[model samples]
Target: MYTALLHQYQLVMSSREAVFNYLDTLKPEDLLKPVASFNNESIGSLMIHSADTYTSWLVNFARQESRPFYTADNYKDLASIRATFEQINLIVNDFLNHFKDVLDAPLTLPKKEGMELTLSPMQLFTHVITHEFHHKGQIMNMSRQLGYTPVDTDVIRF
Candidate 1:
């Protein structure tokens, strides 16, 4: 019943893996350096934020658990960012492994200032994948601005 969504998840994660591999080749300063085009957000910060969004929507909100959030400081280099994402990938796997039965069930997603949005687990899952790619484009742009080449993270490449 969920084959298409599962395939999409695999493709997105693989693309993210390619992005991470490219990040590993960058200089430490470049990863943390703020890009004017990114509203002064460092490349590492963008990646960290995307991963945090996934965890927030999938684990914390979905499971009603308390998880610590990270900031730009947490990802000063590619290695640090990759380590954090590795952990996030595990959490994602667990989410997918157990969510088959409840994918269409309603979920209340918290928002800033005590607001919330109600949606199905499937919707939240799709949002996370798209959200990651959205920020990932910023990361790639920042990388190029910093004079670094980025790996192609297109789903077609996977």
Candidate 2:
């Protein structure tokens, strides 16, 4: 039952939770504070951007479902961002369930300029997760700029 993939994803979520836990320690104002070097993007916005990536790829592109992408204004606190991630969990579960049998198969999607994009379920899953980690690093760096030390947010604890 794809135990390795499932376990790896679970570890990703665990590391994500660690990030959230660290954010939880910060005051709301601090989380919302914008860092000028990152185009004034705050930690909250980066987190929301990560969630939007999950929703956009897994739900919208993969499933051909229409959903509004979240904005930084829509979620400024850990509570709301955490809630959005919970919804993302459901989307991810449905995606895995639907494509469990064909994760390696290519899924072709149409582009606006008469182009086509071909990617496998496994690729898309890897894309989103890695994308999140990329932003996770940004969030950590932003936190440091914001005068907060970051905790370990890697999939492997050691």
- In terms of TM-score, the best-performing candidate is 2
lDDT tens string, model 1, 1-158?
46777788778878888888788788867888888877898888888898899889888888778888887656977777878888887887788767878888888767669999787878878889889999988889899999987778888773
Candidate 1 to truth, TM? 0.86
Candidate-wise lDDT, in order: 0.82, 0.87
Top-lDDT structure, candidate number = 2
lDDT value, residue 106 of candidate 2: 86
Model 1 local distance difference test score: 0.82
Question: What's the CA error at residue 53 for candidate 2, in Å?
Answer: 0.7
The clash number for model 1 is 0
Query: TM-score for each prediction?
Result: 0.86, 0.94
Worst 10 residues of 2 by lDDT: 1-10
lDDT of 2 by residue, 1-85 (tens): 5666677788888999999898998878988888998999888988899899989888888888899998765677789889989
